[model samples]
Every structure is written in structure tokens, then in C-alpha cells.
Target: MGHQQTVSTTFTSAVGERIGASLALVDAELARRYPGDPGTRQPVHTVYVPADAFDAATVRSWGEGALAALDRHAPDAASFAAVLGIPDRLAGPVYDRVRAKLRREPVEDLRIDFEDGYGLRPDAEEDAAAARAAQLVARACAEGTAPPWTGIRMKCMEAAVRDRGVRTLDVFLTGLLEAGGLPEGLVLTLPKVSYPEQVAAMVHLAEEFEKARGLDGGRIRFEVQIETTQSILGADGRATVARLIEAGQGRVTSLHYGTFDYSAACGVSAAHQSADHPAADHAKAVMQVAAAGTGVRLCDGSTNVLPVGPRERVHAAWRLHHGLVRRALARAYYQGWDMHPGQLPTRYAAVYAFYREGLEEAAGRLAAYAGGGGGAVLDEPATARALSGYLLRGLDCGALDAEEVAALTGLDRAALDRLAGRTAPQD
Candidate 1:
């Protein structure tokens, strides 16, 4: 019989206790600042319409316009695929889905813009528009015709327009409250944020609004538009975007990249200013890093290249927009801005094709990991989380069917949610 060998322990439980106590503040900070994903359906794109131009028929008009563009430009699947260079395998399905999506839900997120899109307007005119916007949005919500997410982009917190911005927001909110309560999908955007103090002010403004309205403290969430270079890199040389997130006080739902403004701030020439410019990429890279694990999403800027004019010109523009969108998806920036109704077709096409092309492989990898079976690709827990998230997003955007995902992965929504770390941990 062999004698059992015993291993001696070097450290006592007190050592671990000491280490844990020393890092208590760090633990708390991590929990507070990096709370992880919120497990909600993030819209795939934000369509901006000038507040003065938006009305009850705006959404339906956009859909009709996009569909009309499709009918006139690429009436058939083959032609549409050829225009956008979609592979033969995915051309038909992607085309069909794009048309259906345009008809069913063309605009995922609609923003009634009072900022750049609206430009500078007279005070009375702007106030009336703001109040009218609220009434229209409330009516849409009540009629069940509102998009899944709908909101307004008020003027920035700049000193010149600060008071106007505040009054507009107050008027908008008050009008909503008077018309009815705030809609469930309501969002507010603060653009041209150049300092952390501005974000803090926004938080205070939201708090004051909530208190006055007798609403919950954290009820109002908004997106911070990273337009100026100062918003990305501060005078102190730190990552200003990260500081801005901290200043948001848990009310920042997303950080929206401003393509033209950011590029112009970087001094890119007008001819070369585009979403895929190196400067834009660098800014977005910093944004992605800072927003990681913060439960805050990142939105890529839009391309100004609208698909219109002659057939060849429209095709060229569609290809450009499609390529940029695909590139954005590959970089994990799932949401972007659509400036025109004509861009909607290419947007949905790119999104659907991207998810569909990778669906089989992603499903297989996830299924293997979930089933605890060895596969060609040995994925870690982190990769498993990403795989599940990709599938969930695909499902959310109507790119992938839940039934098909279940059939392939043998894991339903609940199982996928658990794997994606979207469910709260059980003690």
C-alpha cells in the first residue's frame, strides 16, 4: 500500500481576506462603472428627420419612399444583388427580406432632429415645432404606429444655444406629459458634447425634469454625440469619451459618432470626409474601447452618399453605403445612422447578408460549446458569449429566424440568453 502524500498550504485565509479588503474600492468601482450589457433590443439604425418636417405620416412616407426607390432602381432580386455585389447564395433571401423589412419596419429608430438638421430657427418657431413633435410622437404611440424606438435630438449644450436647448427639451417633455405620459421608447439626444461637465449638466437636467414630473430618478436616458475632437481627446490628454461616460450618471444609453462633424473637426477635406476615413476609424476605436463593459452602446456615423439620380449613380452610392455598413458590422458596430430614405434598402440588405452569411458557422460553434462537445474551433467562454450575442442580434433585427436558430443550435432563447451572460447571475 502506498502512503498518501499531503501538500502543505503556504497562505492562510487571512491573506485572501487582506487582499480582498485592500481591493474593496476597486471591486465596487468595477461593479459601478462596468455593469455589462443591459440585455435589451438595440435598434439597428437611427433615421433622422428634421423636427419641422416630421409628422404622423413621416414613418409611413419613409417606408413608401424606400419601397418606391427599390421598385424603380432594383425591381428584381438579381438586379439588386448585382448592384450591391451580394453573393448569389444570399441575394434572393437578402433581397426579399430587405423589401419585407421596408414594408413592415423601415425605420428602426426615428429621431426628430432639432439640431443640425433643423439648423437655427426663431425661438417661437422652434418652440412650436418642439411641442408639435411631442404631440405627434404621443399620437403615434397611442395609435401603435410609432417605431420600436422614437425620440428627438435637441440642440447641444453650447452656450450660444444652451438656454434654447433647455427650453426646447422642457417644452417637449411638458407637451408629452400633457398629451399623455412619456412613451416607453422615448429617447433624447445631446449633441456636440465637448466636455465632461456638459454631460454632468445633462444628468442634472434629467434629474430636475424627473423630479418636477414626479417620475423615477433615472427614467430619462440619452445619447451623447461625439462630434468635436475635444469630446474624444480632452485638454488633459485623457480619453475624454471615458470621462463623458462616467459623467452620464447611468443615463447615457449610447455614444453616437458624428461623421461629418468629427471629420471636419479633424480637418479632413470636404471631398474626403466620410465614415470610413482613418480619422473616423481612430475615434470610433477609442469609443469602442471606452464603452466596453459599460453597458453603453456605440453608433457609427452615416454616409452622406444617398442612392439617387441615374441608375449607375444610384448603384455606385448604394455600393458605397453597403460596403461601409458591412465594414461597420465586421468591426462590431452594429448600429449606424441613415440620413435618407433611399439608404434604407442597402442598410437592411447589408445587415441581413452579414448575419446570414455567418449564421451557419456561428450556430455550429455555439451549439458545440453549449453541448460540451469538442469541435474544430475550441471557443472559450468569452467567444461563446460573443457567438450567442451575434445570434441574438441577428434575431432582433429580423436577419435570423428564432426557429432556425433553435433548430441549428438546439438552444432556445433562454439558453442563449444564459450563455450570452444576459441573465442575472443566480447566487
Candidate 2:
């Protein structure tokens, strides 16, 4: 055999940078666009009420009221299970936890809707409604009954309705600021975005408001609704979600999927429009991948089937809503739109059950992964992040206590906190 020289591999930082430089740039961009960990108290559901019907005092009691409905309709875990079609063994814990959570923090996020929920009124009446919403928000703030997350969703900014949408937003913000400073955790939601220009325009409006109102430059953060096909697909034929988030210029904090509108845009029949429909699922999956690891929050669409009819019919509606919520939970989309107060108990029931079922297993796997111990379960960095987030969310929602988490994972409170990246005490 002829002698052949062996090739040697050499290590060099310059070579490494040259080979992976685009990745560095990509990482930097991702970091810049990423929103960071969501708040510990992120609401499992955002309840929407027509802006005109918003009442500060009554709004505070909506959660309890939802609980009351549950009490009347399905007082025990067995009855709740019967309504949701889940085994009592599965429903029991969720039922108990949901009741407690409703008592503790019935509503986490609320949107006083000025769009679909509040149909277009005369210009003057719309402005008055805006003022009323601001007044209610101010009262909620002062009385300490406001949810940790609350916002207003104005009309869509399409050509025909653009002016009305802008006016509503301007009027609402002006009233909110003049009444009392902006409520804590306030965000604005812009619905039915069809183009990046709409997002840019909204961001510009927010900037102007911040400057004119003497608010912080980025204080007027908003969420874009991915309701239209155009919002999901960019002009260049790529996912528009990241572009939408990018266009917000850090003023965008979340993206909400509007189930009915999105399904309708896909040409699905009105009767078939639903949260778990294939079209809706595809949209949300695209959103998940596009916004993954980016700080921008993702919310699933609403189940419009309200549990409010005759007894049997109401129970049927509740079952439908519960299935939708459970489907969303299985897909790891925690936040969703709850159109009616009657949906709250089922929402929490589904969410709590999802977490409770996975809690012990997730905690063990996370501990083993974090500790680098040999275990049957393996975890990627993303999985680890998700695990930490899962437990922290449970803690925030009152579903899991620090002691319970520590005990389950064999990690102390300090370890759990560090995993959750909690540098400061959670509010």
C-alpha cells in the first residue's frame, strides 16, 4: 500500500467564528426579539367584556360569580366531571384547585373589548364608552380589584375601520391617563392585523402617546391579534408573526389567535369554526414555532360556545368548552380567551388538571436533568426551561406550593427559585 499522510484537525476561534458567525448573529437577533420569561402571575384565561358593559365593582366579582355558576351547575367533582366528561379521579384535584384559585385570583387578565364584543357605535358614543372604560379601570386600580393583567382591545385597523380604531385607542388612552395614571399591567390589543404596516402604525401611535402623555417611551405595549391570513403570512411569504413582533419595536408583548376569524379566513364554515379545528391548530403551531423562545406571549383562541342555556344544553356547552381547554392545555398553550364567565371554572379545571398530572414526573425529570444525574428521562435546554416555567407557573397560580415543589423534586426552595430565574421576589 502507498503511504498516505493523515489529515489533522486544528482548533481556531477565528475559524469557529467564520464557520458559525451567522449563528452568533442569529442568536443575538433572537435575544433582542425575545420577550423574556412571562410574569409569574400570567392569567390562564383573559376574560373579555364589552367595553360598554364594564363595571368596576361587578368586574371584581366575576370570578366568584363564575364559581357560583359552577356551584349551581356542578357542585362536586363528580358533577363537574360529568359535565366535562373527565374521570372523577382526574377531575377531583382540578376541581378542588380551581375552586381555591377562583377564590384567590379569580381573574388574572381581562380585556374590555371595544371591537367584536363592543360593536361600532356612533363616534360620540364610542368616545363616551372609551371614557367609561378608563373610569372603570381607574376605579379598579384604586380599589385594588384590577387584575394583574388588564387591557383594552380596540377595533381592527383595516382600511374601512382604521380611523375608528385609532380614535378609540386615542380616546381610551387619554381618558385612562387623565383619570389616574395607567393601571398596572395595562396593555392594548390590536385585532385583525393584516399587514406589518398596521403594527408599525400602532407602534408609532403608542410612541406618540407616550411622548404626549409624559409616559415612558415603551409604556404603551400592545398585543397583535393573528386573526387574518395576511397576519400569519408576510408579504414575502414567510410567517408574519416574528415580523409582526419585530415591527412592534419592543412595543409588542404578545400575539393572540382569534379562532373564529382565523377559521373564517381559512374559509371554514361558521358552524365548524372552533379552537381545536385543524386550521386553527395549524395557525397556532406556526405561531408557537415562530415565537418560540421569543418573549412574546402566545394565546390560543376563544371557545365561543358559552355555557348559558337550558340546564342540559348548558352542560353540553360546558363539556365542549372543557374539551377545547384541555386540547389547548395538552398543546402547552396555557393562556386562552374566555368569552364568558361561565367558562372560567372549566378553564381553570382543565389547566390545573394538565399541570397536576404532569407535576411529579416533570419535577423528577427536571431535578435529574438539572443535577446531571442519571435518569430515564432526558431534557434539552428548552425542556429544562419549560419544566422550570411549569413549576413556577403552578406556584404563581397557587396550584403548587414551594414546599410541594421542593418535596417533589428533591430540590430546595432556593434551587427551585434559581431554576425559575427568580432574582427578585415574585409579586
Candidate 3:
């Protein structure tokens, strides 16, 4: 016993420090700044209007007008149900709630575009428009009629027009903050970013604006638009999503894919610049992978086809928009751009149908997994996470309510919250 020698199996101090450093790097890589719960009202699409055309009242009216058009286009609940292929029982309720939503707050995220939509207006005119927008935003904010998310899409900072872009941003922000204060849920959209420096510059400007406005450090958030090949694949032949996010300094809220612009960058024909185009898909895939687990939202571009004019043409356009929306949903991009009021109906129709059709199955799987038994079917941890996310998204979108999900999934509010927070599970 006295001759027995002690042996040490513990790691040396240097080796332990190296392991700690490796883990620290991994944690940093997986770090995320979530935008947090968007509350009960999450808009499925953002409707962009030219800067000159934007006003709170007019925007609300646009939504009402869109609802009226949808009503005329699909007169009865039965016809609407047939068009969207939802259960007849849900037809009237879905139509009613959708109309009510549109009437009350037609546009969720309204982007007052000064870039492509507004073009190069006269300086004086643009100044006037900017002031008017700020005034309307203030008014809407005071009245509580402001959409949950609202912002201006400034022109990009390319060398040729960087001055004008900064000028427009300064004027708009100055007026907005002066009119009371920053609107609740205000965000900026930086379009056609070609390099990481562009994002860094935008983030810097946001910091400056926040300081001037007396807002918090991260209050002035922005979403970047991936419109060019360079935006997806940097000049160095590597993906640029992570770089752009880093350059935003944790203030980036979402990444919007510009289908037409990206396709054009790839030299694709005008006839084939749709969201489902291969080039667009590749860009979106790169975006998803880079932004995964980062809480950065993704928005697909709009369908160029507008549902107007003759009945046949309108119907055809509706079919096209609906098809594209379905494809986006399949790809897990819940939000897209709605170019016209008419597209509103199809947007909701497709969204409601997508969630509705899979409700029961998703519910069963989630309930089984959450119950710990998992007796219904084998579920990997990732699959469990996906099921929970699907239900949570539906709940956020108002497609499914707390009580409904609870009844289907046997999960109460607290359990659902826990499920949402279940990023990892010990095996």
C-alpha cells in the first residue's frame, strides 16, 4: 500500500486554457442578437410605397382598398375558400379576420422608398416629402395607428450617390426625431449593399443618429438587402452574409433578398427573374445558412406580376403570386414583398392555407415530442426544434392562437414558452 504511486490524469494549465479559448470562439460564432418577440401582430409582407406617396392615413386607406378589391374579386366566402383551397368551415372566419386586419392596419411594415420607388426627385420636393413623412409618422405614433414596423429605405452608399443617400437619411431622421421622437418599431432598410464596408457605414450612421435622437445604442436598427452577386459572394469568393452581419454590429434585423436585381446581376433574362429562379435560390440558401440561429429574419422579393385589369389577367396574376408565395413558404421564408394591393389577398390566402393544411400533423408531432414519451414517432433533436418552431411561428402570425395550439399540442403557454427556448437537449 505504501508503495502505490499516485498518478495524475487532469489536464495541464496550458492545455486547459487552450480548450477554454476554443470553446470561447465557438460561443462567439454561435452568438446571436434576437429582435425579440414581435408581439401578436406580425405582418407577413411589407408593402413599399414611394416616399412622396406615403402618409399614415393614405397607407391605412390603401389596406382598406385592398380588402375591398379582394372582396369583389372573390365575392363570397365559399368562392374565396375554393380559391385558396381551405376548409369551407374556416372560409368565413378567415375572410372576416383578414379583412378586419387589413381595415384596421393594412400595412404592417411600410417602407417609404426613396431609392428605386421614388427615384431621383427634385431636392426641394424630396425634402418636403421627407418632412411630411416624419409628420405623418409622428401623428400615427401618437394615434397608435402606426403599423408595428415602419421605416425609410434610403438609397445605397455607392460612390456616385453616397452623398445624396446620406443627405436623405440625415434629413429624414432629423425630421422624424424632431417630430416627437423615433416611432415605435422604426427600422431602416439599406438596399443594394455591395460590400461589408457599406454595412459598417450604415451601422455607424445608425449609431450617430441614435446619439442625436437620444435613443438607445441599438434602437436604430436596419435590414440589409442582398441585391447583387457581390452581396452574396464577396469579392474574395466567399459568402458575405456573416461579414455583413458582423459589420452591422448587432443592429441588423433582417436580410431581404432582391430577386430581380440579383438575377440581373447574374445576367439572367428579364423573362426569368422570379423568386424561385436558381440564382435567387442559391443566394437565399447562402443567406439562410449564414444567418441561421442568428435571429436575423429573411424576406423574399415581390412578384412583378400585378393582379389588375381584366378578370382573366387578374386571376392569372393572382395564381402567379399565390404560386410564388407558396414556394417561398415551402422554402421557410415566411415574409415577402407585396407590390400591389391586389396581392394582399393572395398573400394571406397562401399563408393561411400553408399553416392550416399542416396544423394537425405538426401539432401531433410537437405534442408527442414535448410530452417526453415521443411515442408517436422518433424525433431527432433538430426535428423536435423544427416542430416547435413551426407551431411558434403560427402562433406569432395569428394563424393559430394560444388556446388552439394548446388544445392541439397539449402544451400550455408556459410549456410552449419552454419549447421555444429549447435550443439544446441532453441525450
Candidate 4:
């Protein structure tokens, strides 16, 4: 039906094959270095408790405390919405969901802190605390009372505390092994990491532990806490974060930003030290890029402002915390650190409002894209992936109901999972 071409093609299949062969090494390297997201349900926030202070009742107590705060201050949807400026359309739903989430799962990811929160205790006291932490965590996991994710934060790999940190981790892991096998949601955090060697050291520790326990390799994964300037930028003037991730050797699950420590490391005045500071932004931005496509999630730091004291003071703190959380969500930092239970209300409120505000539009666009029907906005596959991911996250956090998401997007959970590049669950 068409006219024949007059000229012969200059390139052939052989030429393309040669080019592919030449780039095979690069393809393999890319696959190794940037494996993309792991497609797991990342927790919305990580709550840190002192190793000695954590107990079976800690999770429930936090939930009760958060509920009490809601009752005392913003007792209803309208009042809570007024404090956080939630829209009328979203107020009741967000308020109801926030309360339900507090009652159901107040803390998603919990870290038993032996670092800053625990401070430097005597060797004996720290040892006892570490053992006790393992016992409580194992028991909680067995009783189905633990948060979905729970872990310990050992001290840094710095020379001063290197052996002590290793010893504490050993004791903790040994305790867990003795009690039973390690739980599936067990996490480890190595804080104040300033060099790639520290990450390597963590890997080594994990490997040695696995070998000694005869456990599977790569079974233990930890988070690298980026708190020092050196962790972001090396003395050789390169993005040290990339090297840190590399040194992790496929064992780093996430990178957590430390607000005050990082700001203070940058010489930020105590009064000016906040998560929104320019310095913190730069650190987190670099973290985001370094973590992108690397299967490592990013967590923003916590705001030290606690919603305690008089009702007026609590309201002000709630407003501040809510604004900060919303800002972080806008920047695509889905997870953060929550220092106190008081911040839980505003945290959920901001997260819910963010998803709810954009829900209709996102759902419409995704539905159109999935159905191959044109929409106002031309969306690429990547955008579809993000949109599906957004809705799935909302659904997972209870901000969006599964039925409503299915109705809005015209795609069920399995369809969403496929679009988001996650493996659908087996029937």
C-alpha cells in the first residue's frame, strides 16, 4: 500500500547487537546500583523510645496519651480542623480516621534508642537495658502487641563507642535468638554515621552475626542515620552519601535525617535549629536524590516542639507541627520521626489532609490513564506509577478506603499494585 524506500538502511540488527554488547557491563552495573524501590509498605513515621523506658505497655500507653490529648484539646472534628486548618469537606473524615488510627495503630515503626535518647549509661546498665529490650520486643512480637516494625538504635561506630555498640547489638540479637527467631519487622539503626566505613562496619557486623548464628545472609538490614556533615559531603568533595549507600552493600533499608544533630553540626544556633531550616533541607534533598532508585527510603527528621503545657501552648505547637509535616509531605518525604505521642494527632491530620485534598484529581487521572481514556493532563507511565503509589499509600494508612479508591480509580488493589511496579499478592 505504501511506496518502497529508495535508500537502504545504514544501521542493521548486527550493529544494534554490537552496541548492546558494548553496554552490557553498564547495564549490569545500573541494575546492581539502582534496583529501585523494594515495593514494601514503608511506615509513615518512626517513634523512638529509650531502651530502658520501652515496655509492653509503651505502645498502648502512647496511643492512650495521644487520644487523651485529642480529647483535652481538639475534642471533635470541627475543633481539630480549626487547629490544623483542615477543610470542611475533609474535617470529619480526617478526624475520624485520625482517632481510629490512634486506637488501632498509634506507632507504626518504633526504635528502642540506645544512642541520644538513651544517652551514655554505665556499661552494666546499658548491657542490662539492651538485654531487656530484646526480651520485651520478642515478647511483644509473639503476643502480636508490637508495632508493625520495631528495632534498636545502637550507638555510632565511632571509635569511642565502637566496641560498646557492637557488644550491645550482639547482646540484643543474641537475646532475640535465644527467645526465638528474629521477628520479621525487626529493624536496626546505626546513628551518627560520618563515614562509609561505618556502613561497612555495620555490614560486617551483620554478616558475622549471621555466620555465627547460621542464619541467612543479608537477613539483617539497618538504617543509616545521616546526622553529620561528613556523611553528606566527604573531605574529597564528593557526595559521601552515595558511597555510604554503596558501602551498605544491599543492607541499608532507609536513611533517616537527624534534625538537631545535623543542624547543630552545621553550626545552626539552637534557637534556629529546626527541621525546616535551610541546612536540614539541603541534607534531606541530597538524601532524597541519593536514595532515589536505590531501594532505600528517606525519613525526615523530627521537630522537637512538643504539644504539651497549656491548651493555648499545645494548640500553637500543634499548628507548627502540622505545618512542618505538610511541608515534608509536599516534598515527597513520606516518613518522619515523631518524638512524642502529642505530635501524633497533627501528624495524622496533616498526612490525611494531604492525601484527601488531592484524592479526587489523582484518582481521576489514574482512572483515565488505566482505562486508556484521555484526561486533561497527559500522564506518562512514571506519573501513573506515582499516582497509583499515592492512592495505595493512602489506602494503607486508612486515609482512603479500599472501596472508595477502587470506585474512584476503577482499579482494585491488585491493579494498583501492578501499576505501581509492586508485585501483586498471590491469591
Candidate 5:
């Protein structure tokens, strides 16, 4: 772990640090796009947000009032307590309900969002909520209050320009620091990352925020919402994401496929924005290419149509958490989301099963290789060759325990020792 940490710190530059982001070496950009190919069978870490929750009237009201309190907070005992209590008082029920739902969700599939998961709108009332949510988000990141991962759709730079006086994006970040001293490593996702410049600008802002807030700037992660034609097929589209990271100092952590916006960007029928659709898959591949090309995590957007009726909902839950989730995991997603509690179990199972399956496959290969006493020729097309990379990918998921890895391969720590000397590292 220590060695690995050192390697990451070396490779990943912190925000605002004078680190150089070099992508000029890749030569050409993505040669091929991911046909929204979910990938080689692992659950993508799904950050589920409650878009509908933000629509509720009460949430909107809470946003306005939260900021009013922030504006007048002072250096008095009463004021300080009032400030401390604000999050608990205003965000308590909202957080509790979300937390409870997460806990009870049929699966341990992780869900991340704030103020109900969607980005804050620019309306006056919602500004305060956005600020509060930002603070809450920071606290969660700093404190590990929930799962290890979470994502937020912060205000787009364009949106900020349109909103006039109050810069909601900055407020959101401020709230985060005030809430809990940057307790968490938050993944701030930007919507509609159309041009490389947009991506670059956002990265710069993120880096600035980190420096200003006194947090490890590079530690502040990011996910780009790929939803524009310019990002996919434009003349520079192939290299758009590449260029963005190069210019922005390489802070991108993941590239997410935004289906709805992609459909529109493609000038296709919006009604047919299903993941299974050929066009949607094409766009996902574009995103995958960008991600794969740049060595970042790739995630697909949520399936919009959800099951609602009792039986349908149950089945819907299964289809998503199991069918889709399993399929996605098998395609090699780090994790994926169950939008509702009902879908959680299947999502969890699929994610777990992915790593478990891989571990077992790897163990068998390594054990057999050990038995061969280094004389075994690992047929590139067969068990040993396949298992090498296979096992490593399983480890990447960070889902399995050492014992679990051992169980899958029937190899104890001692056996692994022998194999490591005999085998080469898998890709």
C-alpha cells in the first residue's frame, strides 16, 4: 500500500501544483471508440443521484433558507452553534432518508449524490440549497461518512455565466470547506463537457478551488459528462478529451456516457435514448475510447425508463440490478448504481460476483502454473495467459479480500510466493 501510494502521488499531480500534464506522448488520440461497450464484465461504480428528489417543492425551499443563514453566520457561540446545527437541522431528514434507503437497498451497490443527486439549478431559492449541499458533500468526503466514493454534478461554467451575480459554483465549494474542512475526496462531475476547452477550464477551476481551500488539489477528483457532438465526432473530437486533460493538467478520474444529451448532440430522436440503442452504444464507445485512451475510469449513464408497478417494479429492479448491472459488471465496470433501493441487492450481487468469478479463475491458473514448476508454457490463448491479466483486474476492483482471492485459486500465501517469482505481471 505504501509503495502504491508513492506511485500514485508521483503520477497524479495535485490541483494548483505546478505539475506538468503530458499527453503529447500518446501520439494519436483514441483510434477506436467504445460502442458503449460496457467492457469486460465488472460492475462500474455507479453514482446514483435522485433527480426527482430535487424536483420536490420542499427541497427548493430548503435551498433558499440555508444560504440566508450562511450569509449572517458570525464569530459568536450562538452563531457558531447555529452554523453547526444548520446541516443537521436542514439536511438531516434528507440525508437520513437517503442513508436509510441506501442501507436497506437490496444490494451494497454504492449510490452517491447531493440534494437528491442532480446539479443545482440557478433559481434564487435553490442557490442556498446548492451551497448547503456543497458543504454537506465536502463533509461526507472528508469524514468518510458514507461509502468510499460519491459524485456531484456541479454547476457548469456556462450556467454560472447565465446566473448573474451569485456564483453558485464557488458557493458550493465554500460550503464544502465550511461544512467539514474538506473531509472527503469528492468527485466533482461536470455536465456537458463538449469542448476540450470546457474540460480544461473546469479542471483549472477545480485546481484553484483546491489551493484556495487548502486541500490536496489533485486529490480532488473529477468525472466528465460526455454529452456533445463536438466531444465525439468533431474534427478534434477524437482527441478532444485527450487535449482537455493535457491542457488541464490531467485531473480526470472518469469519463461518463451521457445518453440523453448525446442523443440530442447527434441530432437523433430523443425518445429513443436507450442504452441498447445502436446510437447510444456508439456514443458510449466514444466515451470508452476517450477513457481507455487516457487511462481513466469509464462509466455509462443510467437507463431512464424504470419499472414502477408492483410486479413490474420487482422485475424492473431485477433487470437493472441483475440483468443490466450484472451485464455491466461482466463488461468490467468498477461498480454501477441501483436508482432505487429495490435494485440495490442485484447490483451488489453482480459486483461481488464479478470479482469472485475473476479471483477463482485466476487462482486456478496460478496454482496450476506453480505446480508446473516454471516449466509450464502458458499458452497465450489459454488458462495461464488469460488468468494473469484476469486476476490483476479482479484486484483492481478492490472488492475481494486476500482470503477470498486465495479461496478462488486454492492457493495460500505460500503458493502465491512461489508463483510470483515464476510468473510475469498481467496487464
Candidate 6:
């Protein structure tokens, strides 16, 4: 028995040493990934610009301006991707304006009406513009010089999938796909989504597109726009929302809350509803909880109706309010989405704060544990709890991986053996 105990401890100690060496090496490699300094995290925001907001020169300026602001504020972000949503009619001219200036991938969302018959095929002008936008997207993806994330947002309807059913949607998506419409890294945004079946239908179309092109249709992603009356009231307070999400496992990439449409659906006056209102918080919480640790990013809805201007107060407060909304989502542990160029600084700030808090926490716990001395039995339940919490936070945020726990906290891999109430401090 004594010999076995000796062998086991020796093995664990040797393995812990190797793990520490490996972690040190990985830290060096992670530095190369620009994992950012101590005060940094990924600031991902979905950028939205109104169709009428900018002309050609104005559009280029906006794209460039967003880049500059992101660079200035959230330099540590892994990447930035935008979603441009507007009527199909305006996309071409808008694309012409912003295409040259954007450094990162900018997605395009075609505001289509699926409720109408056979889907509204655009008139000549709109068709031409959509075609041009499509061409631009293909050019960007195929050529060496285009943006990193090229995508599309098509429409969805309950009548088609529910009462009238999704046959109409199938036809519309087929046309979009056939027209050389879908782009690489394409994101199909489903508005008025009520169930997983709707998502399944979209996924089916993506597979068809893939087979046709000999590409991995499985790569197509969905961003559920939890808009419309159905999604907000929890689709008539259904008990199966969690099931709906599970059914959509392969399809969903993120969840987006549309406050304007959501408010209208819920029939609350605009005055009574704010983005951070308890109601909105409840709605967003449902999504954040649903998406937590599932790898699907959660995007908060837009603040809506902000003026692009020189005044710092309006922009400042706007950023601050949105930052609060974002922090709420972060506290719930969602990584990112939805911001204008001016709000870029807040996006970075929130992410930085998120990691900074964790890093500070981990450093504190490690220090205390080290000071406790090897084999120390001091049991301040409160301070001991902090060590477990620190380990979890680091694991959650990717600061310290699972293997590092053995070395850092001296915890073993088995359940119930976690070093929660005990530790062996370094000499």
C-alpha cells in the first residue's frame, strides 16, 4: 500500500511538471495568436447601417470609419463581421458605396417579404441591384482580395411554414441559391422564427445548395432573428423552446433579439420599452441562457434611432447604454453582436472588462494559495471558495485550460476529488 501511494504521487507530480512546461509553451504560442494583453477580449459586434444613411462617398467613409474606430477601441478582437440589412432595391448602390472601403467581411441581408404570394420577386431596378450585389459577393469570395465573411439574410414566414407552410420559402431560397445568390460564410437570418422545424427547412435548402455546387452545404449557418410576435412572447408561452433549440443543433450559429419588432409584437408602448427594460432583459436572458456554452454566439438587438453626429454626449451615452446592455449579455456569458461604428469603443471595453475581472481574480486566488504554504490546512471557507471560482472562470474564458488546473490548483481529473477545500501550496 505504501509503495503504491508513493508511485501514484510520484506519477502525479511528474505529470504536473510536464503540464506546467506544456502550459508555458502554449502561453508563448497563444501570444503569437495575439491573444491580447492582460486587459483584452474579443469585441464582436454585428454592424448595421440604414439604406438611406449614406450615399457612395458616405458609404465608403462609414466602412472606413467603422474600421478606424474598431482599431482604436477593440484592437484585441479576433475579428469583426457586419450584417447590412436593407431592401433588395437599395443593395447594389449601397454595395458600390461600401465595397471598396471595408477591410473585414461585411454581410448583406435582403429584406424580403415571405408573407406575400409566391414571395415578392423584385421589380427591374431591384433585381438589377440584387444581381450586382450578388456578383460583388461572389467576386469578393472567389478573388484573393474580398472580405473575410460574405453572407446573406433571407426572409421567413410562419404562414409558409406553419399555416400556409414553408413551400413558398423553399421556392424563394432556391431562386436565391440558383441566382448565384448565396455567399461563402453565408448567414441565413430567420425572422419570425417560431420553431425548430423552420430552421430544419432552411438547413435542407443549404444541403441542396451544397450538393449542387459540390461544396459542404453543412457549412451554411443560421442566425435566428428572434423577431415577430411569436418569438417574443415565447411563442404563446410554449414549454418546448429548449427542445426547439436542440433540434436546431447543426443549423444555428447565433441568436439575435429584435427589440422593435419584439415590442410591437408584445404591444407595449414605445415609451414603456427600453432595451434594458426588465421586459427586454427577460427576453434576452432566455436566449443567453439557452445559448450558453453551446458555441452559438448571442447578439443583442440594435439600440435603434441613433444620430450620426459630431456631438460626443449623444454618442457617448448611446455607447454607454448599449455597453450596459452588452455587459448584461456578457454577465450571462454571451460573446458578442450588434453595434454601429461609434459604439466600437464600448464593445472593446466590455470584453476587456470581462477578461480583466477574470485575470485579476485568478491572480488573486493563485497568490493566496501560494502563500498558504505546501500542505497548509487553513480553511477560510470564503477564501477557499474563491479558488474554485477562479479555476472555473479561467476555464470558462480560455485563460487557463483544463490541463492547467492540475498544475495551478493541484486538482485531479476525477469528479468529487476537486481541490475545493484543500490544496498543496508551492514551496
Model 5 score (lDDT) = 0.50
Judged by lDDT against the true structure, how good is candidate 2? 0.82
> What lDDT tens digits, residue by residue, belong to model 3 across residues 1-427?
6698879887789998898898996666555444333323345888888987776566767787788777677877787777656687678767776776667666778888989999987778877887788788778888888878888898998987687788888888888788888876787889999899999999888888878767889888889999989988878888888889888888888899987888999999999989988888899999988777666788999989898887678778888888899899999898999888888877877777677668889889888787777766888767866777777777666567788888999887556656665433211
Better of 1 and 2 by lDDT: 1
Compared with the true structure, model 1 gives a TM-score of 0.97
Give the Å error, residue 188, model 2.
0.7
Instruction: Estimate, for each residue in 234-302, the C-alpha lDDT of model 1 and write its tens digit.
Output: 988877999999999899999999999999999999999999999999999999999999999999999
Q: Write the per-residue lDDT of candidate 5 for residues 1-427, one digit (tens) a residue.
A: 4564433354434643432335333323432222222233233445455433432222223323322222233223234223223223323332233223334322222333433254455466556656655655554446444344444565454554424212556666677667755534455666666677777777667788878777775766567767776666767426465554455455776776666777866777867765556786776665655565354677766665553445445444445435555555555444443454334333433444555545654666576675664433463334453454455445444445566677666765434533332233221
Q: What tens digits encode model 4's per-residue C-alpha lDDT throughout 1-427?
A: 5998688789999999999999999999999998876778888899999988898899999999999999999999999999889999999999999999999999999999999998888999999999999999999999999999999999999999888899999999999999998999999999999999989999999999999999999999999999999999988898999999999999999999999999999999999999999999999999999999888999999988899999999999999999999999999999999999999999899989999899999999999999898899999999999999999888877788889888898899989989998773421
CA lDDT of each prediction against the hidden true structure? 0.94, 0.82, 0.80, 0.93, 0.50, 0.48
Prediction 4 global C-alpha lDDT:
0.93
Query: If the candidates were sorted by their lDDT against the true structure, best first, what order would they fall in?
Result: 1, 4, 2, 3, 5, 6
Q: What tens-digit string does per-residue lDDT give for candidate 6 at 183-216? A: 5445456666776777776667667766875766
What residue pairs are clashing in model 2? 34-295, 35-295
Off by over 4 Å in 1: 1-6, 424-427
Clashing pairs in 1: none
Better of 4 and 6 by lDDT: 4
RMSD of candidates 1 onward, in order: 2.2, 4.4, 4.8, 1.7, 15.4, 13.9
Prediction 1 global C-alpha lDDT: 0.94
Q: Write the per-residue lDDT of candidate 2 for residues 258-361, one digit (tens) a residue.
A: 99889998999989999888888889998888777566778888977888877797798888888888888778787899887788888887777777777888
Against the true structure, candidate 4 reaches a TM-score of 0.97
Report the C-alpha displacement of residue 233, candidate 5, in angstroms: 1.6
> lDDT score, residue 213, model 3?
69
